[model samples]
Target chain A: MIVERKSVDLGELQLDSGETIPSATIAYESYGELNEARSNAILIQHAFSGDAHAAGVSKKDGATGWWENMIGPGKAFDTDKYFVFCSNVLGGCSGTTGPGSTNPATGKPYGLGFPFVTVADMIRLQKGLVEHLGIEKLLSVSGGSMGGMQALQWAASYPEMCASVIPIASTHRHSAQQIAFNEVGRQAIMADPDFEDGNYYDGPGPGRGLSVARMIGHITYMSDDSMREKFGRRRRQMSDESSLFEVESYLRHRGGQFVGRFDANSYIAITKAMDTFDLSLGHASLGDVFEPFDGRFLVISFTSDWLYPSYQSQEIVRALRGRVKDVAYVELPSSYGHDAFLVEAGEQTEIVRGFLASTFKKLTPVGAAR
Target chain B: MASAVDTAVRADFVPEVLGRGDYQIIGEIVADGSSVLDLGCGEGELLAWLEAQRNCKARGVEISPTKVQKAVSRGLSVYQSDIDEGLADYPDQTFDYVVLSQTLQETLKPRDVLHEMVRVGKNAIIAFPNFGHWSARFSLLTTGRAPKTKHLPYEWFDTPNVHFVTIPDFEELVRRDGLTVQKSFFLRGDRRITYRPSLLADSAVFLISK
Candidate 1:
């Protein structure tokens, strides 16, 4: 199905940093129909560098959704059975009010002058959109990576609004290594001469810098085993400055493509939001953060995902189990590294399909006739 | 975490799905509406059965990723974990029943597992093949080999059942550990063998407490 992107005028939104955006708009896409009780709504959150197009062919460019594999008619999310909604986050370039958005105050793109945002602010904007759609409580709030962090935030910050939370290949907070990698990406963008302090709207922007940053990101997203298998020892040529590795060639192509689609300023805004995100911040412990929450949780991690390892997922499960809350956990066997949640959806399709069906069944009360 | 709550999407839960006699006996031992943890729960057939038929809260730990998938698909709460290394995450007296069905012999440290089970649950229902059965004994005495009968089907060299225990051996350990055997059921296929059960029964199930 060809899907059209819709935008909601959410006006001003308060940031976690005590600042406020003059006007906030969220670009979104929805699949399936909302039932009478509005209980079948499942919110799909996007990861860093991802847009609101989570499923269906986009009308703007005819590009397939980012998570099209698992969010279609009979797929894991099963749009036919549940109303699946995805929104571009607060500090995103994809039609959402971010660094790319025109600032009402100056009649120019926010660029470097955009008010700083956080994961909490992202969810807060999404919350406005979800509530605008007339959904009181989501049947589930689900996502992977940064999306997963949003999912956990939904369950934690708005416990009564989410019936269940699915955080896949994600963590409650960024590890030192995770922050370090994101920092490198930010530095690559800032070092570009064309970047001009995020005010490159009148120029070519930071295309080269953003490309190199994405190249670094692509490396962190794959596993050693996958890299070896994908581009063995195949070499076309050799040079001191240019080591003609096929992997390097491939990364360069991917990085260049990323620059064509993503904005460098938004990249900085989103990454900083991700780097500072900590679900347990200020709480005595991780367990303490979830003490008042009663929503069910489903936590998934991949075996080869060193960037966001299975142990991180285990920590969430451990905290939930300690509270005697309803939770399930599995470290699936995969060689796809951090991209397993997106790349490998076969077993996840089965596991998610089952988990959602059971939860929906419980919510639908059988009458005395049964 | 890919392992926990996405509650509403599991397959249709069919009550009375489990037909195993030992599971039925164990189900009887479990109180209605109580919480249960099944170790080595396979695809969580018994846990699903308990949840649907008995209105009990069912949870499980299975080592295989494949089985964990099946159980989650079946609407059962299961963790993918080795049973020996699983219970440490849970607090004391977390469950009404801790089940180890046909899996005790495969454990590297059976005694330690038993101890952990009783510590984690108010009661534990253990079921294992009786190594002292008449057919098993006859096979060992007559052929002078590691007994390979219907119950203990594997050959000695490749057997996964590393710790072979008779009814007497288990009872002695229970006594040594100061555990109380609340109930016991000896089975020869579908029939209960109360007369000389140690020599006649193929498998045995015991409901014990600390």
Candidate 2:
């Protein structure tokens, strides 16, 4: 129920090429009491297109959001024990200002005119929000997928701001295979006639193109085993009974559901941001990216997630172990693929609870160690 | 808890803290933070220290129930398993280091246990009192009986040193199996016998890699 919206001056968002977005607005939600010591505050970074409403049933549409499984009273990131914060990214559709929002200067949707944003840029904007909430050092920062990328960036960029980090089902950089997949999705949207070169804001915009794009994304989100188990070649019971393929039906349902809640412009912007997200892109190496992050780390990966496989998590742990053994990694056995972090409740809940308990034990006052 | 543990422990006990001969030999061996599976881990003292000081996690296979209890009480993790039956439950390369310490000479099937150790670990560390020491040679030659020293403090009938091996003899055996020696250390009392340990030392330690 506790939600808020605020626009902060991020100076000027100078694009990778040569452009500038004069201003930006960041939407965020905060819950639980921040302890007096200011160490119990946890920042929950939202994934691609995911809004600040990470928990609770939506007031507008009587439905729960993506991470509703674990961010409640007695959940893993328990609001009862720690302060929780989640915010819409720099370029997102849901409540925060994005390409679909009106430009204060021209009084029209920014569309493609919105400045290109990076994972680092998202972390920078979140820094403003965290400071606005009057929290100094975060007890821990955690998230999955795109959210996981932000957590990694937060720990790498602002090492002293948090005591620990838990990045689930994420990588330090986008692999060539992932970039190609996103590129095809973007191409699908642009090829649509309704796309209108990103200017069809008032009228029917690239819904079909965006739906197809989501279909491609949905395939990657789940594992083959998960799809086979959920929807086999069972006939949909009709006169002819020439039922659609199980995967076809499943993709159609997911695509329709996404199109209902999301904007095509937002998809273009967020996916582009993810494509640009390579933490080790310009850094000396993977190890150097984490050299500054001296805090304890709990990195988890799913056994079935071919996208951002366990090797990526291992790379992060290997880099950290080069410095110290404060890193703990647990590859949970699951068949849910990349989405396992959100769906595999039992495995994630146990690992996170155990990790937090251990981190808290280490971070407890020095006098308590004896 | 500390007082209760202290009261239960016997007082006359002074752990071998590795004499100079043992220390010099063990120092040359790789005792880093490896996944170690130690056989006949007495009191689990060395394993616990390795874990604490070297970040090496270890699992001990001890035959003595009393020693297993003592090791567990000291916060050292251990399992009661037999070595001769082969480490069938453990997969290949399950450990980086498999150590026999000073108990290899006492095993019923030393060769079988050594082969199993090599199979489970990439490398193995073995340490034993040298039966070829000058004192042992003198006793055998003059008294026509097995020699006893401070290091090998047991009578001929009760001694566990059945597989009596010397530095050169152990080297020959290790070479016969095509195993390469990573390092070797000779121990004489609390000092290292680096010059001619085969003839001068009381104990020898060798680190071997298959």
Candidate 3:
């Protein structure tokens, strides 16, 4: 049986420049047994728009998570052997405090009034949760895309805190192409006549705008080849007159489904944070940003993902290689585009399983500790 | 495996460098704690030697599957990749030293390979069989065939050496590219020669920085 628990609180977390934010509620879930050693705990970060329901049946939906394929008994991130922890990001909307959460000070939904949150702020909240759970060190950290960004930040900010880090399909910074896609999505949301300067809470506040934003986002998440293969000029089976183009039907399905769960203001807030994320900022250059990292890293990339191309992952490998030989890289052959990580179960599970075992060995009494 | 006394009948077998050349090439080029990318790293004998002797961490990029498997089996990380395709996959200056040992002559484009090697690595060490050796000259003039000796041992039809180069030829190529030759070594078997060895030497090794 899986033992699950959640801790939601408005804790005080001090920022980097000594600014303290009060009443920060973070929703998280933990599974399995926390051993007496507390060293077998593993931290799994969710990607952009993902919530704390990383594994198992969520109470909200009574359904499994996006990564349901490899997070069960005897699975890659097996709960039988290790305790796993996953939390909603600081700037997320799902069950956690975000733009949709009510502000204690003003007694109104934060909405557009929420202060800007960063990847560093997300890591800080994760640190508090880890500390709250009484875990001294993590066996491994695993994540993909925006989740990978958080994992990399954790490894760099607290190098000695984790035994190993596995970052998948992510770059040190958002590239020009990524920035352009995000900008288009944001524009789609803001251009709607119903947006009304982001005060969309009371009346029918830009549901169409939010759905359009999700449509653009879904398009970017898939590859051109996948789109051509899935929707190549074919019309919808039932609604021929309503949906003439096959691509339009696909986009409408995605956009319609997303409007049911996601909040538009949270979408704007999180994407803006991701756009401004630069792991190499504040440091002299790329080399200097990674100079202080002294840990084992496993960087994985997908071959078909043009959004965050394999070359970007190779840059991370190169930067780590500049300082240490413990870094390893693998670009998996996949045709699922940027979503390959969530779809290519066989290759993704193998790579992650190998990485987990190695990290476990490093922390266990069987081998040399890192 | 041929002993120095017995191998004379066959022409294609070139003896591997059993010991270090006199100048200690790996140590001279590698920094105190550097990562090396050894291209065409045959048998990984030199890389193992460098690691155990000098405490350097070495990874290899070899074309031959047999050599790459051998290197990995020896606990040295090596991958099979073609350098001629460009190092766009590898970020700039990922390695401190990139060594191409006696394999540059066989490449389709030597100068383009050099730029790629330098692009991926901070410094490059290239060693090749000197075509200006007296025996090679004598063989070309007297027998009208490509040279087949201890170092350059291949028939003209089957030789992998597409571009046979001498010390002066390589020097001219380097000078034209605005690259500097940091150090140079001329080898006759296992000893180093200080005198001009363009005519007498059987092979030459060079350390260049771009």
**Every candidate's TM-score, chain A alone:** 0.96, 0.92, 0.94
Q: How close is every model to the real structure, measured as TM-score?
A: 0.93, 0.67, 0.71
Q: Model 3, A120-151: lDDT tens per residue?
A: 88898888888888887888888889989988
lDDT for model 2 = 0.73
Looking at model 1, residue A273 earns an lDDT score of 93
Model 1 DockQ reads 0.58
Error of 2 at A247 (Å): 2.7
**What's the C-alpha lDDT at position B88 in model 3?**
44
Q: What is the TM-score of chain B in candidate 2?
A: 0.85
* Per-residue accuracy of model 1 over B10-103 as CA lDDT, tens digit each: 2122224555567767766777799999999999888887787668988888888889889888767788878888887778999889999999
CA RMSD of each candidate after superposition: 5.3, 11.4, 7.7
Give the per-residue lDDT digits (tens) of candidate 2, residues B1-210.
224543232111123333334433343353557777778876676666556444676667666545654554454545434556425545567678888878778888887777778877898888888888888888778988778766677998998777888888889988999888988777777566688888788877888888
In terms of lDDT, the poorest run of 10 residues in model 1 chain B is B1-10
Across residues A1-370, which tens digit of lDDT does each residue of candidate 1 receive? 8999999899889988899997899999999988888989999999898999999998989999999999989999998899999999887999899999899888989998988899989999888998899999898999999999999999888888988899999999999999999999999999999999999999999999999999999998999999998898776565666576789889988999999989999999999999899999998878877877776788889999999998899889888877777787788999989999998889999888888888887777875111
The digit string of per-residue lDDT tens for model 2 on A1-370 reads 4334434554555555355566766777666677766777888877765788877666656566567787877777777877887888877886666788788789999898877777787787778778877888888899998888899999888998988888889988888988888888889889999999899887788888888998998888889899889877764653686777777877888888887778887888888888888887787767777777767677778889988898888677666644432555556678999889889876566556655654555566866532
